[model samples]
Target: MSEKIYVPISPPTLLESDPRANLSDVERALYEEVLKHFSDSEYQIPGIEEKGRLTEAEKFWLSYECLLRYLRAVKWKSAAAAITRLESTLKWRREYGIEDIVSASHVEPEAVTGKQVLFGYDTRGRPALYLFPSRQNTDEPTRQIQMTVWMLERTIDLMGPGIETLALLINYGDKAGNPSLGVARTVLNILQDHYPERLGAALILNVPFLLNAFYKLINPFIDPVSREKMKFNPEPVKDGLFTGDMLMSEWWGGDQNFEYIHEKYWPALVGSCEARRASWLEKWRALGGKVGLKEWEYKDIDTPQVVDTKAADAKAVVDSEKISDVLTTESRVPTLAAA
Candidate 1:
């Protein structure tokens, strides 16, 4: 008898009526406190106002949502702690030329390896990012880090209304070669320090003993909150917080075979990224370079209640192509999530 195949199901729309509707009381308080702190002249970043790059008002509006992210990362523990974290990230971004990283003309060569892909959104509407460690191509640490950052920015652009976090799925199957431990540490630091409170869940699937041992070695370095969000090799359908149908057959232990073709996948994926970049540029121009002002004002214009139909249509096409490619190859592409 043939094995049973699970079909993915769409989850109900979970977008909040008000973006702040989901914030806890403590979170709301911290949000206001952090906003006020930044708005105060004494606490302003030195040289920001002197340089006239941004007025005090623009700076406060721009840093609004980002401050909340840091606050939530620390569980609203301390305003000082959140500001410290945010300031560090801001400095890093300035030095790293983050704006250039996001607007680069071409995707990095390392990114085309199909190692990491933004598959789809999870049931909770958070973007789902998949990492196939086996597909890692470059030994250059800088390239690895850059590729990670680029993909992260891409994933952030996919965030919709009421979606502030992302689901991470790391597949450690058919081991290629050992990944650089130092590189891994740097990547983790970036996530924990700069992108705090952005992880919804991290699922590690098909872990080999050696990798599991490495995970144990590094477990101590991970924060308690992040460590708690990790789940390993559980029944995806029952315990993984994702339906089997939403995942690839190989990783989810389902029956729908799929395979990933880099050539076919890259064009569609890159096109989607380009479209989003264009839309973002248009909005930035319209806002006169004040990107996060509305969001900071606790206004609805910052977050759209409905996902962009054009973007959604493009994603659906990519999904259809992915399914078709898998069916043609008689193997599934190791998907990490379903919409």
Candidate 2:
């Protein structure tokens, strides 16, 4: 049969009248602490237009704290198991596209821009990664770039520092066209700055137009001092053309000359990604390091009441509204009584 999937979430929402009623005293303390942290400064989220707001990094960290506790307590093991499964599904999708991939699994399919959206459990069995088939307009670089940043932050929250070696499978298709150099630079900057060790491993298929654009855009941005070592130079490259082609040329009617650089080339391109992440981290630190993000880190924040399984179905169930009120309450954290 198919593997069982579980989505991780914090305590259910409570009504305004019964917010603290459902939470244990200790749990309430934790929540307060986390909320207080967010009241500080944050960067502007790309898609979110609110000015003078907490940065996405800060929000992500807070969410991560809650997510870590929830996943560690119940779903960590299963989430790890799902990674292997994700690889398998991704491989199958690469071979046959979305229709065949979805048919092979138990996930329900949704349509986004006339393409299939395959939702599945991530390393933590949470509603983690949402895979989408290539589509027009929607999957363009603008959207993809935004999504990439958002996902990276979430990845850091879920897996923590070690997730630096994570690999992503990008479906390049004939649909939305290629992303621009600005997008690539933005993505690279985020990785190099925040998640220093995390290097992205991507498979660009279908749309070759982006290859030249990305190359040109990135070539000049290479660190001047490290230009010779860090730069990627191709032979007589052109804009909007996919020249190097997919690494798996055999599958696409080539003489297999495009083997993985790490696998077959002298550079050793194909292997565990841990080293790449490490290299990125080292280089990023060498480049003067990142600024402080005080708003993002959850220090001494109030914890939420973890509604365990038994409590989920208790006789006197609390309403979601009440839970929401507690979550939204701006009241100063009242001191705990001496016990």
Candidate 3:
């Protein structure tokens, strides 16, 4: 089987104080207070000189759900803290020129050996991202990090309405050493700081002593709250996020026999992603083509208005050796639907 249907996503993790989530009066109040902070035009950061406002484009990318993520990350208090982090991310996005990496040639070389692969989905239909340190094909830290961002952005773009996270699988196969503490810390910082509350889980496999020690050194850089989501040397099936068939086979572990051939996998992966972005952009433009639009709206997926604070709700293996199918059916709109 090339693909299997999965359950809708559960209420994404850690949504404590959002009306759109568990719809308690307390949650409604908290949601409003956070909104109030950004809803005002005169909002100001205590220590910053720039306006504490997100540009329309930035707001579009941040989405209402994303703001709630930062709020939940801070335990539903400290609107100031959440906004501060949001502002920092906006600044970083500008300085980083992240959009350029979408089609960047510099990052292409790193992915040539299929070091990073985005394929399939977990039990709740969260996109699965696989990393193989053993497949390391590059030595440049900067471009390596850019490739990480590219992969992440693609993952997010592939998320369905009820899904907001990714199932991260890191398989450090034989003799594939660990990243420098500096590189690891920088990547962790990006995930924790800019991409708050977005990791559904991190399943690490084949951890060597060196990699284990490397984790110890980077512990401080990881947020304690998010740290709990990391599972070391986990049984993917028993851990409950993935089924064997859905998991990548071979060095990664699972039922399917799959191998990554860069040429075929790359184009299929990029084509699928571009198709998704095209669909999203079309819907986004229909909805005023501006920011402040609810993600669930342009996302054009069913979601609850008021909730019980509960839950919610990919494929392609081209051949035996390629990924003809990358984005799962849920992630990509059919041409007719997109139109």
Candidate 4:
């Protein structure tokens, strides 16, 4: 059988999964309190006031999953601790201008060499992000790090109800594209602080002696949990992490000939993610709009609800109106909810 494939979302693997799952009664109560806190507060960004008015994207950002991720980061220990980290990330996002400059065009140059390709998925349907440091095209650390952050954000966009993490494939060929220790630390800090639990695995390949030494230098910066996720010289296909067609071809791999032509791959990836987000936003809006909404509701929202037009026509309510015409399934896209 083929391993599970994913694009943005490939439907939730489980019905009773999170935004908040595996919580004790107390932890569940704490989640509710955190929700209340988010609801009652107004988070102000640099140029935008996220108080009474919230755009779709803003609403999307302050989503139920986003909060739960932070709480999970702190191991559901203290609501205050989770809140502190959450607030810090919000501040960093403002300073980092997540809404303003982190876009396809802004990070386009860094991606031209196809150094970091966001392609494929693990067996759990988590998006696979492959890094080829040898192809690093820019010397500017800021843009480079921005590109990293941008990719991380893109992976989040690609996650689904039961899927909240990404598979990181690092191919440090000749260690040429390896970043400085300072840059590595900054990236690691950002991942642990802002992203927490979002890294499903970091499959490292082609570890030269220098690269192994380099990992030692930055090992302390990596949290124990993340370090646990890292595996050197992984055999993904053999281990069943990925199936043949889905893994990156020619390397660290199964059989996907994932050639990264920036012009083609970049636009497709961004556009597809945008479409997935729009689909999710539309579904969320139909249910009275919520930063309060649970992620699993997507599964609930997609439950089959067929309308009987014949029965409607027999009733006295607008008898002549063609409800069937407006409610046909002819134009519906094949959504993950159906899977």
Candidate 5:
């Protein structure tokens, strides 16, 4: 049986040049403007900047790419809004101990249930993250959330240049341990708000009848853009969007005999993470020193609206049956089955 390996590949040449080249004229201009704004010392996130852990070179690389990601997330419309969001994320990272997460060497034992794993890349070269909810071993909501975030961060770091997005394959094979609506909502909020434009596609596989009903109840809250990107059990391998040879035999109709072995996979992932970190540090040391955001600036923006859980639950109950019908109808959409 052939096995797939995950490692960081070289970034695209375009990124090596001016990262702005990847954007449109309008977007490029906005990216540059935002970059300049963040370069200023006055614009620093209070406690984060004060730490002074990041070297000058690291700051430059971070400011350049980070600002671009923020702009891309908001579609480059509002500079003030993007800045506000970026600053908020920096603050959140500080509170969340994201730095420690990246540096950690071992996978959380509870998180390694042979359920969620990073597979090969998609046709677009975006990494594919597979999740088997039925294999979930723990009901601790916080740990689940943490594992989700950890996987997301690792996937993001593994991204190659020109491939900022990712593909998610959620296998609801029995639908026995599906996360609750509240958990789903929290994950959605994190992705929509913090990781903008990061999801290229979400392919839900082996969805049971009951799970389809749940999808229906929760579908309304999902943004239209996100809804458009979602596919319910697509045949990418058959359609040639993905090569069957590259997929594990357990899923996607491939022939390769692949099974999740936690003991083996976890150590490989740790090594990959360490190597990637070293590569990033080397690159930062070489180029990070020359770049710096001299002065900082600040802007005022309103906080995002909070979700009403009570109203959401009531609505879900009211629309449960209706959602089944909606899913049945939507299943006929040609693109949904086409990868």
Candidate 6:
């Protein structure tokens, strides 16, 4: 009998030794393709105006953002996997010039890892808001604030006529002593008083003030051509609505120009969510919240009566033909005998 060989399992740690440990072959190939396209000499920041002078702290944070963006796109499985790819990806690593920083060396894992994302898509399956920003000014902090407002407005719209939800996302980076903050607080107070029947959940994402400078520096790399393509020129929904070809075309067109760093990898995740929506909704209702279809809410309501003038005209023409012979004794006797 041959001796059995035992494989050793690695212990969990904050740092991983190998950079390629996290990468699947396909993912590694995709990473290389993306970097090859984006890392050309033309992509370099030319001057201080486009890419501002970076301090040591700013350099560290920007590199962290870049690594997380790539890892997030890949959907890594574990902490070790996430860190390993973060170190090996030359596109991001070259910017920072170092590998993963152990959480223990800096701060506790809970401090950074425990923080939740600020705003998520709501229960109604619509985004809370559409953050449409002017291409002229592309500040990340500003864009984040705009997205926050969009989320709040969308929530209120979905909640129905009289109901409201209390929510706000503030960027503390903007004008520290500004009076607008007080105005925002007052508005929320008024809304809370108006919608006493519903529970309000407030979400706040407080990004560090250093982010203002970060966006300013990275503006040159923001892909201007893509932004131009994404501009919305509204058309009547009735023109091309619900055409399968149109939907797929629009999806494909938008996909080629720009990629949302956070949302690109969510389609597969959402497919799983769709599979579980029915059960998840039932569990949500069991927790004491109301669950009913939008159509159900309007069941008793009557739609406006529609009279077709052409149909009425056709009926009048048939009546004028005077078909009384069909109802006469001769026609009726023959019809009855055949029956």
Q: Model 4 over residues 4-48: C-alpha lDDT tens digits?
A: 222222322322133246678888787888767666545443343
TM-score of each: 0.71, 0.30, 0.77, 0.80, 0.74, 0.20
lDDT of each: 0.59, 0.30, 0.65, 0.67, 0.58, 0.27
Candidate 4, lDDT over the whole model: 0.67
Give the distance in Å from residue 73's predicted Cα in candidate 1 to where it truly belongs.
2.5
The best candidate by TM-score is 4
Least well predicted 10-residue stretch by lDDT in candidate 5 = 293-302
Task: Count clashing pairs, candidate 6.
Answer: 1
Worst 10 residues of 3 by lDDT: 7-16
What are the runs in model 3 whose C-alpha is more than 4 Å off? 1-20, 23-30, 33-56, 301-339
Q: Model 3, residue 142: what's the lDDT?
A: 89
lDDT (10s digit) by residue, model 3, range 1-339: 445322111112211123445546665566666667665666643444565455555656766687777777777666677777777787777667776534546578888887888766665656788898988877889888989998898788767665677889888876787888788888988988888878987888888888888888888888886688888887776555565656666655665555666655665566656676677777877887654456666666433222222332132121212212233334442321222
Comparing 3 with 6 on lDDT, the higher-scoring candidate is 3
Candidate 3 yields a Cα-based lDDT of 0.65
Q: Give the Cα error of residue 173 in candidate 6, in Å.
A: 5.0
Q: Put the candidates in TM-score order, highest first.
A: 4, 3, 5, 1, 2, 6
Clashing pairs in 6: 129-150
lDDT (0-100) at residue 18 of candidate 1? 32
Give every collision pair in model 3.
Answer: 8-313, 9-312, 9-313, 10-312, 11-311, 11-312, 22-309, 314-328, 316-325, 318-324
lDDT of 6 by residue, 1-339 (tens): 222111101110111122333567766555554444333434432233444333332232222223334444346444445434433433332342222332122222211221111122222111122221211132233332333333332233232211222222122322333223333344333233222212322222233445345434543443343223221222212222111111111222110121222222122222222333333334434443221122112211123222232442233111111211111122233321221
Q: Which should have the higher TM-score, number 1 or number 4? A: 4
In model 5, where do residues sit more than 4 Å from their true spots?
A: 1-25, 46-63, 101-107, 289-339
RMSD of each: 8.0, 22.5, 6.8, 11.2, 14.1, 27.8
lDDT by residue for model 2 over 1-339, one digit each (tens)?
222211111212211121212545555454444344333445322333344343332233324333233222223444333223322322322333332222212121112232222111112112222222444335355445444444443333233221222333344544544445576576565444334323322223343556546555686654332233221222111321112121112222211132111112211111112332344344434443332222122211143333232333232233333222111111211110000
Off by over 4 Å in 1: 1-30, 36-64, 102-107, 253-258, 277-339
